[model samples]
Target: MKEDYLDIKTPEYVAIQFQIAGLGSRAAAFIIDQALLMLVNILSIVVLYFVMVGMEPLPVFLSHSSFPVAIVIIGLFIINWGYFFFFEFFSGGRTLGKKIVGIRVIQENGHSITLLASFIRNLIRLIDSLPTAYFLGIIMIFFHPKHKRLGDLVAGTIVVHERKAKKKKLTPIEKEINLRGLSQNNLLLDEWTLKSFTSKDWKLVSTYANRFTQLPLKERNQLTKQIADILLPKTGLDSAGKTERELEDMILIIYLILKDEWEFEL
Candidate 1:
C-alpha cells in the first residue's frame, strides 16, 4: 500500500515510518498560531498605550519625536520574531499550534530541530509572507512532494505527525546477543559510561539504534562515526583503525547491551 511517511533508520538497522503532515493540517496550525500572535500584539499595544498616557506629563518626552513610534515598531518586531523562535527552539520544534495540531518540526534526517535551523526557518518567514498571508509559502507547500514551505526547504526540515513510539526491529545479530544476555559481554560499557547518559541521551542513542539500518549506507556510516566519536572517549574505546561498518556495529552493540536501562528510562 502507498503511504505518506518519512523513513528513519534505527540503530537496529530497521526503518521506522513517520507520517508526513499534509498542507491542510499545516495551514490550520499556522492560522492558529497567527491568531494567538495577533492577540499578543493587541495586548502589547494596549499596555504600551496606557504606559505612554501615564508618561504624558514627563518633561521633554515629546522632544524625542519618533521614539514612541520606533518603540511600538520594535515591540511588534520582537513579538513576531521571538514568539516562533523561542517556542520552536525551546519546545523541541512544537509551537503551541503545532502541538495542538499533533504535528512537529524535525530535520530531514529525523533529528531534533536545532537552534540555528529554527532561527533560519523563522528568519525566512518574511519571504514566505510575500504577496500577503504566506501566499508564496502556500504555493510552495502545494507543489512540494513533502508539503514543505520555503522556510522548511531552506532549513532542511519537515513537519510530521507526532509519534508516541518509534520502535526498532531487532536484527538477527541483536537477537543472538540478547539470547546470550548482556551480562556475558560488557560490550565495552561500564557503570561510569552508563551514568554519563541522561534520559534524553539514552533516547537519542536508542533512536539511532532503531533507525540505523534504514538510513543510506553513507549516512549510516556518517552518523555512526559521529556518535562513536562522542561516545568512544567516555567509554574509553579506541577507534584507531576501525572500519565504518565496524564502528556502526559497535554502537549497535552498546545499545543492545543497555536495552533494559534504556527501556526503563524511556
Candidate 2:
C-alpha cells in the first residue's frame, strides 16, 4: 500500500521518515485543547468571583482599583499561552490533545522540538486564531503540502503521527546492532559524551547512515573523512591504526553508537 511520508535527510546522512498528521487530526487536537482551555477559564472565573465578593467590604479605593482587573487579564493570558508552552515543552512536544490523537510536533529537520520554537509557534497561534474560528489556519493547512498551519510554518515545525510498533521483541538484526553499539570499547560513551556532538553533528551522522548505500563512493569518502576528523578526538576513539579508507567505517560505528544512545523522539 502507498503511504505519504516526509523524508528528512539529517546532516549525518540518515534519512528519517515521518508520517504527517492531516487537517482532521490537527483540528481534533485543537478542539480538545480549546475544550480544556474553556474548563480552565470557567474555574478561574469562579475563583475570581469569590475574590471580588470577598473584597466588597474593603475600602472603595481598593474595590474599584485596577489591580483585580489586571490580575484577571494576566490570568487569562497565562491560561491561554502557558497551557500550550508548558505542555509541548515538557511533554516532548505532545500536548494532551496531540498525545490522545497519537500525533506530535517536531522540528523541520526532524529533531525534537525546542522550548523556544514551542513559544514562538504558540505565540503566532494568536494570529492563526484571527477572523474567527481559525479560518486562516484552516486555509493554510488545506493548501500546504505538509498540512502546516501558519504557526507551524513560522516555527519550522510539523505535526506527525507517532510511529508505534505493535511487537515488543527485537529482531535478530536489531539485537545484533544493539550489541555492536554496546561493545566494551563504547562503555565510556554516555549521554555526556554524546553531548559533545552538536545537533548539526548528529544530523550529519544521520544523513550518512540513511544515505550511505546510495551515496557515490567519492562523496561518501569525503563525508566519512570530514565527520571522522571531528568526532575521533572528542569521542576518544583511537584511530592510530586505521587508514583513510577505514575512516568511513569508524564514523559509521560512531553514528550507530550515537544513534543508539540518542534515539530521536517527538
Candidate 3:
C-alpha cells in the first residue's frame, strides 16, 4: 500500500484543517476552565455563607437582599473573562484550552492578531453565544467553509494550529544550501506568493483554462511576469529563460518548494 501524507501546499485548504483542530482544542479548554471555575466559585460561596452566618443571625429581609449574590456573580464573570482575555490576547493566542488543543488564533493574513482584534473578537462572543447554547456560532461553524464564527469573521481572524516541527533527513548544510537556492531565484514563487492568489485567479485558472489560452501571447506573458515579480522576492528561480511556459514551470516549482517535495529531474 502506498503511504499517505498530508499536503501542505494549499494554504487555504490547510487553514481549514487548522480551524477544525483549533476549534476542538478551544472547546475542550472551555469545558475544563468552566468546570474549574465552577468548582472554585462553589467553594468560595460556601465558605462565604458560613462566615456570614457565623457573624450574626440573618434577618429574613437581609437574607433576600440581592447585593451579595450580585457581587459573587460579577466576581465570577470577571475571573472567567480575565483569564480568557489574558491568555487569548497576550499569550501568543493560546489559552489553557488552546494550548492543550494545539491551536492558536491568528490574523487572516497569517500574522499575529492585535490586541484590538482580540478584544473585539471576545466581546462579540456575547452575540455568538446568543439564543442560549451558542447555537448561532455552532451553525456558522457548520455552514462556513472556514468554520468561522461571527467573531472570527468580523475581526478578520482565524484559528490555526502552530506548525509542528518535522524531522528532516537532510543534513544542516544541505538544508541551508537548499534554502539559499530557493531564496536566490528572481522568478520563482514561494509559499506566500502562491497563497496570495486571488479568487479571480483561481477561477480563471481552473474554470476558464480555454479562455486563458485564447489571450494574446503578450498579455499572457505580462500576467506571468506580474506573478513572477510577486514571487521573486522570496524565491530563487534559474534565470536562463523567460518564456511563458517557463514561467508556468517556475510556478510549479514553487508549488513543489512550498510543499517541500521538490525533486530535480536532471
The lDDT for every candidate, in the order shown, is 0.81, 0.81, 0.63
lDDT tens readout by residue for model 3, 102-132 = 7788777666788888888888888888888
For all candidates, the clash counts are 13, 15, 4
Residue 232's lDDT within candidate 1 is: 69
Deviation of model 3 at 225, angstroms: 49
Instruction: List the candidate numbers ranked by lDDT, top first.
Output: 1, 2, 3
Q: Identify the runs in model 2 with alpha carbons over 4 angstroms from their true place.
A: 1-3, 59-62, 65-67, 166-266
Tens-place lDDT per residue, model 1, 1-266, is 34478898977788877899887888888889999999999999899888878886744865486878898899899888888989998998999999999999999888899998999999998899899978999998888888888899999989899988749897855664466454426575668777886676667678887776578888888888888887667678887699986676666667765676778655
TM-score-based ranking:
2, 1, 3
Q: Against the hidden reference, what TM-scores do the models get?
A: 0.61, 0.61, 0.52
Q: How accurate is candidate 3 locally (lDDT)?
A: 0.63
Looking at model 2, which ten-residue stretch has the lowest summed lDDT? 179-188
- Say which prediction, candidate 1 or candidate 3, comes out ahead on lDDT: 1
Best candidate according to lDDT: 1
73 Cα displacement, candidate 1 (Å):
1.0
Once all C-alphas are superposed, what RMSD does model 1 give against the true structure?
Answer: 15.3
